[model samples]
Target: MQIYNFSKDNGKKIGIFNSNFIMSRIIETNKGAHIGCMYLEENGIIGYHQATIPQLLLILDGEGYVCDEKKEYFKVRSGDSIFWEKNEWHETKTETGLTAIVIESEELNPSLYMPKKHWDVSSVSF
Candidate 1:
């Protein structure tokens, strides 16, 4: 598992038509890619399972915790992007709920687009 960031801090300023907004590019897909939105209600959980394909979860709103194969949970929030390799075990849970975009494909390579978060995995908990 790898965590990347797409927060406003990493966005590019959009000056088109004098607009003062920033846009963060999320991902570009190849053929046969599947993309969808995932809505987890309060106290929700996406039970741990092996990824069917390379997956990228882009948190669009709220916050949550993600667990890897080691059973260690890490805090995640809006603008955070989590990637898992095919057959990798992972789970997601939130006490308050969250909305995210999930992209699955066999050709996913997020590192080429977003910068990886320098997180301290040693600080992870259950």
Candidate 2:
């Protein structure tokens, strides 16, 4: 697993006409992609399981913890994104609730577009 920042701090300002706003590019895929929003209520947990395909989780609000095959939890917050390779074991849980957008596809390549954040986790390998 890897973490990336997609906050406004990393976005580009768009000034079209007289409007001004920041836009953060998420992903662009020519092939079909699976996208969905996840709403985990307080004290919720998404049980550990192997990813069926390359997956990216973009935290939209609140905070939560994600664990890999090693079961070591990593704290994540809004604007933070997590990536997992296909068949990688992972799980997500929260004590104070969290919301995120999940993107899955075989062509997902975040490293090519987003800047990766160094995680304190000992190693991504399990």
Candidate 3:
């Protein structure tokens, strides 16, 4: 089994317009699992994006609002976990700096359900 230290992982900026959000890949497929950590600055927005595999977001600190294509929103904070279905459009609104761990499967194939032209952010691969 592979292990990862999220605190030691260096986060990289993946978005073109908003660079305040940082993402660090903790574990990769080569390690037998996929995991990562995301840190969003206060007022930072990740914009609409979707993933290939269903993911679980476990909030570690601060608070934020998660929204999807339906415009539905949910308040999240430390100890809260949210599950995002594959191919669903989603975004985040962080009121305070938000830190979270995201777990997904690398074995799953990903397809962008949303049009590329509609994406205001950039996609980063680990």
Candidate 4:
């Protein structure tokens, strides 16, 4: 077991165009389980991306928009959480910045649970 301090961990650049978003990887898989917290600046956006491992997102602060390609956008704020399966394409747009904790693990791991077809990506396969 390990403890992570988001404020002290330091944030790193994650996006292509804008470098305002910062991500601090709190925990990572040594035995195939991954957990982390990401902090974003106001008006920052994390471009669309997909994960090979399944993930669950727990919103910790601020407000934002979460969306996939096919479905309508959803608003996310503090105390909200969502799950995304492997290969699902998603992105976040924050108007007031946001902080979220992410938990993910290998697909074969029974301890990890993921949503089914959370997004409508065509080519990607998990």
RMSD in angstroms, all models? Answer: 1.7, 2.8, 15.2, 13.5
Candidate 2: segments with Cα more than 4 A from true spot: 119-126
The residue pairs in collision within model 3 are none
Candidate 2 global Cα RMSD: 2.8
Which one wins on lDDT? 1
User: Would you give me the overall lDDT of model 2?
Assistant: 0.88
lDDT of each: 0.91, 0.88, 0.58, 0.60
TM-score of 3: 0.56
Q: Which model, 1 or 3, shows the larger TM-score? A: 1
Tens-digit lDDT track for model 3 on 30-122? 334467999999887778788566665667888887776566666666645565667877777786789887778644222211111122343
Name the candidate, 2 or 4, with the larger lDDT value.
Answer: 2
Model 3 alpha-carbon miss at residue 107, Å: 8.2
Candidate 1 on 46-118: residue-level lDDT in tens? Answer: 9999999999999999999998999888999999999999999999999999999999988888887788987
Q: What is the lDDT ranking, best to worst?
A: 1, 2, 4, 3
TM-score of model 4 (CA atoms): 0.58
True-structure lDDT of candidate 4: 0.60
